[model samples]
Target: MNPAMNESSHTPPLVEISGLCKWFGEFSALYDINLQVNSGERVVVCGPSGSGKSTMIRCINQLEEHQAGTIKVDGREVMPGMKQIEEVRRDVGMVFQSFNLFPHLTVVENLTIGPIRNKLVSKTEATERAMHYLERVHIAEQADKYPPQLSGGQQQRVAIARSLCLQPKIMLFDEPTSALDPEMIAGVLDVMIELAEGGMTMICVTHEMGFARRVADRIVFMDFGEIVEVAEPETFFNSPRTERAKLFLSQLLGH
Candidate 1:
């Protein structure tokens, strides 16, 4: 077993994407993307700009429609216009590059919206749950403040707390730290590391190699919409097989 995924187990896949293809008009954004994330595994997807790392994760939750192939969440195939998509999405939590919190709502209110609307949680109950996650993220004091009133790191913490309120089975992060300033990145990654240590099944699209090596069970590299390589972090960073992957890692680690 690779040291990166010391506790990695061969359980059934929680999220499976096979032969997945996506396009924007005439341009293909993903080409035959395939991946499977097992329960309690944390996979980090890395690539250069325009490499479709974000698009691939988006397809897992149907945020971006795919043109071909299958995405199964917890054994149910995800199909557009299918009623099960809502049910599947309810169990999947996503955090985007931007902290998409409602600026007008207080931090706690932002966290409560999804559970109250979809989970049928009582306002009082939702607030309590929100506070729990906020505390977990080390930002309970910011709960009553509005998104705009907090720093970038604080707002992103609120976003994470909001997702946790939904109690998702799988968490997807699309460049969650990319938008933050250098100093603020550590705070978000710290929370993500905590989540990983707690055995959360997670897939993150990020360039943060330190986080990938320290917390990821596997590192998946993509280029030109193709999954170039997938391996445990030690092998991937130290001895990538594919030239594309080696070049990509050299560029990243050499900096």
Candidate 2:
């Protein structure tokens, strides 16, 4: 094995991105981005709308293709190639803001399909795993409920549980709480905090500064398709290095 592989064998980063760039037509959505996330590290990315924060996480799971640069998950490259992308996605799960559950299927059914189809687990085994994660997200009680029947918070928790059933090495969350009521946000954040505490590698795009402060090992700030700043939550929040970051924080924190 390569020395890099050997070193990673001991302490592998779950995901790495280098010189990442993405564009649509002539417009750049992300620019020359670089980042690494070690196994079990929790990172929160925040930026103003249209800053490419959502696009960045979407690329990690191959939901969006980067016109340039490279992304790796668990030492495997993620690219437009089908085999590589599928392999990477198998170990990397994503939860979206809209909670894309199957309205026709019950919660348990939604959670079981992916693992059974992709992981090739038997239905019995998949259901058991689904129940385990459903319990973890505190919604096993709603396992039989349809998506429309649950509150937004409950639905998001089900989405989390569905992703977990895949046994992904990393989880990517795109504005997971953005669509919820203020009162409902805490329930989803609590599950996310528990996931972080239990050592799951996670990359989340959210404006929830309190959640970032409490859970993130690092916070990345982006603007106009560029990563302007990356730091520990305390440093990023208290003494931002870039003027754009300061101005952004001013807007977020309200002076």
Top model number, lDDT: 2
- What lDDT tens digits, residue by residue, belong to model 2 across residues 119-206? 5699999999999999999988998989999999999999999989888888999999999999999999999999988878899999
Clashing residue pairs, backbone N/CA/C < 3 A, model 2: none
List the global CA lDDT of all models.
Answer: 0.89, 0.91
User: Worst lDDT window (10 residues) for model 2?
Assistant: 1-10
RMSD to native for every prediction?
A: 3.0, 3.1
Can you give the TM-score per candidate against the true fold? 0.94, 0.94
How do the residues 1-255 of candidate 1 rate in per-residue lDDT, one tens digit apiece? 323245445445788899999999999999998899887789999989899999999888898889899999887898767776877888899998889999988999999999998866898999899899999999998887889899898888888888889999899999999999999999999999999998888999999999999999899999999999999999998889999998887888786
Which ranges of candidate 1 are over 4 A from the true structure?
Answer: 1-11
- Model 2 bad stretches (over 4 Å): 1-10
| Collision count for each candidate, in order | 0, 0
